[model samples]
Target: MEFHSNSTVFHCDVVGSDAHTTVLLQEAVDALAVKPGGTYVDGTFGRGGHSRLILERLEKTGRLIALDRDPAALAVAQAIDDRRFSVSHNSFSKIQEVLGQFHVDRVDGILLDLGVSSPQLEDASRGFSFRLDGLLDMRMDMSQGQTAAEWLASASEAHLEEVLRNYGEERFAKQIARAIVAARARQPMVTTHQLATLVATIVHARGRENKQNPATRTFQAIRIYLNQELENLSLALPQCVQMLNPGGRLVVISFHSLEDRIVKRFMRQLASSDGMPRKLPLRANEVRLLSRQTLRLVGKAIRPGANEVESNPRARSAVMRVAERINRT
Candidate 1:
């Protein structure tokens, strides 16, 4: 997939229907408090489900800048012929830079739907799923970076264990890592089924039974580590906060616990008053003047409704958190 300066076109063949039932569709956009004449950003343009909704709420003068690391996603984003919308082939972490390129200092709202998209997961060649047998490449951006197969082949057992434990929260990480190291010595682990089978074999022996596939956590760990998903989120959060104008909304929909934890903590830290000694001999007004609050939490985290989850199982794990930029005097 090649990215041009003005527009990015994806060369890879896209499999399956490009249609994605975006989780919390109306809820997420509503949280944005979008202003028809103001500029906004969609950090993850997965199939443009949310982008289209945002555009509908915007006027002719309103602008929407969409960003995505996946070439396939960029292809879908390019289909939007609206003059008010522009797509960028970059990660959400580069939100600030992308805004600068558009001469946008701050935006009225920013929406980020993090993690892998349906199209990427459904396409076997993209290697995002273990259920479908394909290459062991789980990269969000296949244009660059080492594939999951290459990482597994070269990573030490300790490193593998660390990733599985920290990123995937897998309990049998040590055993799985040991097994991977031993198996790779006999032959290279280069396919999704190969890796999945290896993990299932080890996990099953431990007598663990659940609805989810045994290889789920391992696949997630490898994908997260290889794609630097968590790191990108950490970097993008501060940038999103800084790029929002006063009263601007920041809506984030995270899929897993790890992602949700980071979002929750970041928002809490910013929403809390600056840590100051309570014993200080200062009046209430003086304390209010001294306290620094960057954000006002909108409400509690939101989860998909039972009907939505039944229709789209992927939405089951999603959690949306909303906040607004606090205007400082």
Candidate 2:
């Protein structure tokens, strides 16, 4: 379990064999329109799913620089021995800085596969899934940041309610937050089972609309809040755009509605020129320049097909968006 990411590269045999199937794997890489000698970025190198396929498409001259917050993912990324491929242990939000570290000013393409990976969810030790019981620690990057358990222990009931309401979109946030406060007063909420069972009892009595565990929203809320998932996505999107070469692609596959909204709005806004009409006489080139449109939308948002969803239910919620950087100059 102790996978140190330093001067050594450990070849993990099971890294690619994990149960977590990369959702929209082919679709994502294809959207990149990989050029043989172009450089690319895989913002979230979860289990090296996209990274492996991307490397396959690249020629020896093509370079791919990947970034991930998870230590386990960094270890898995090391398994790739190609000289053209390199990975940095960091969040995608720091993509600009990561590029600096590699002495890369621009890239031909960038792919960001957001949300909790299957390995992170399946590994109970990581505490992503409410269905499985483990430590309440839900830090995406185990190396740093406050654990979910620690945050829950100190967070005010009001703060917890706000997180549940905003991040989870849970309707019963207030009641659940109040109950957590009451329960924690008697005993600290330290484990996944404790929090799950507590939320379930509260939700089961009031609402029974879905088959999913009643604690599902609370768990998601806590994970997203503690890990700053939405915040990171907001920060990374602009950097992804800034780092891409003209005619390069930016592909993002988001699993959460909030994440998808940010991607959708950002892409749409960039692809449009805000419909700015010239009040004064201006040439077509000048109008185009004044418009400030930086990207062209690729097809429409893509979702996993029914067959793929059937095989991997997690893929059901995936939404993939693509846009190509336009030559503004």
Candidate 3:
């Protein structure tokens, strides 16, 4: 999946009829408030689902800059032939630098569909799905960093436990971590099923909270830690806020509680402004607002409609939050 030539236009297609549905597609794009002839950024680009819609809403002069850490996605992005479109092969965390390269100081809108793309999970070769017996590789950017298997093989018990508890929110993190360490000492922990089985064996469920697979949390923890999903997200959020033009929108679709919490807190703090105390204050109309309010939260987090979720179960976990940049007086 190599992308070459800036002039080529890509018409992305589903390789199989079974390609995963892009969760919360319309809602995320609508939140962008996309306008013709305005520059926008689709930070995750995945299969160009959101990107194509953004381009359609733009006028001839309007530009859309799409970024994806996955080379596979970049390849699809490169295949698109519109002169108004350009693709960057970089993580959204490097948003500032990548946008700077194009002399794009500010954008009309930015959209981040955070977390793993569907292809990364559906493709057995990518090794992201626990349902398949593939390699334990889960890096969004395969060109760099350690695979999940390598990390698990050498990670300390304490560090593994911390990741499981913090990222996966699994109560049996300590036991799961111990199991992995002990198992690896006997033989290198490789392959998805192998690790999954190890986790299931150690995490016993005796009570009512026993329906879900025991390996689910442990796998999620490893993937999140190895990919640094939360850290990357934290880095990207402020960059998105800083890069938007006045009245520009930032629409984020976060799949898990941690990501949603970060988005919620960032927006709440921005909206509240933590204004000065009403010390010796004048009338309410005469009061001056705080100096640094940059963002205004759009609305409450949006979840998928029941019909959409029934069609694509992956859509069930998605939550979209939107915020708009304010004009600095």
| Cα TM-score per model | 0.92, 0.92, 0.90
C-alpha lDDT values of all predictions: 0.89, 0.87, 0.82
C-alpha positional error of residue 96 in candidate 1 after TM-score superposition, expressed in Å:
0.5
Where is model 3 more than 4 Å wrong at Cα?
1-18, 205-211, 274-289
Candidate 3 clashes between residue pairs 3 or more apart in a chain or in different chains: 9-79, 9-80, 9-81, 10-79, 10-80, 10-81
Candidate 2 structure quality by residue, lDDT tens digits, 1-329: 11223333333322433546899999999999999999999999888889889989999899988888887887677667677888887788888987887788999999999988888988899998888889999998887889988988899999999999999999999999999999999988888999999999999889666877798889999999998999999999988888889999999999888889999999998987645555668778868765678889999999999999999999998999999998644
Poorly placed runs, candidate 1 (over 4 Å): 1-17, 274-290
Instruction: Give the best candidate by lDDT.
Output: 1
Question: Rank by TM-score, descending?
Answer: 1, 2, 3
Give, for candidate 1, the lowest lDDT window spanning 10 residues: 1-10
Task: For candidate 1, write residues 100-178 as lDDT tens digits.
Answer: 8777899999999988888888889888899899999999988899999999999999999999999999999999999
The CA root-mean-square deviation of candidate 1, after full C-alpha superposition on the true structure, stands at 3.6
**lDDT (10s digit) by residue, model 3, range 31-116:** 99998989999889888888888988999989999888888887777677777887777878888888877678999999999877
What is the overall TM-score of model 1 with all chains considered together? 0.92
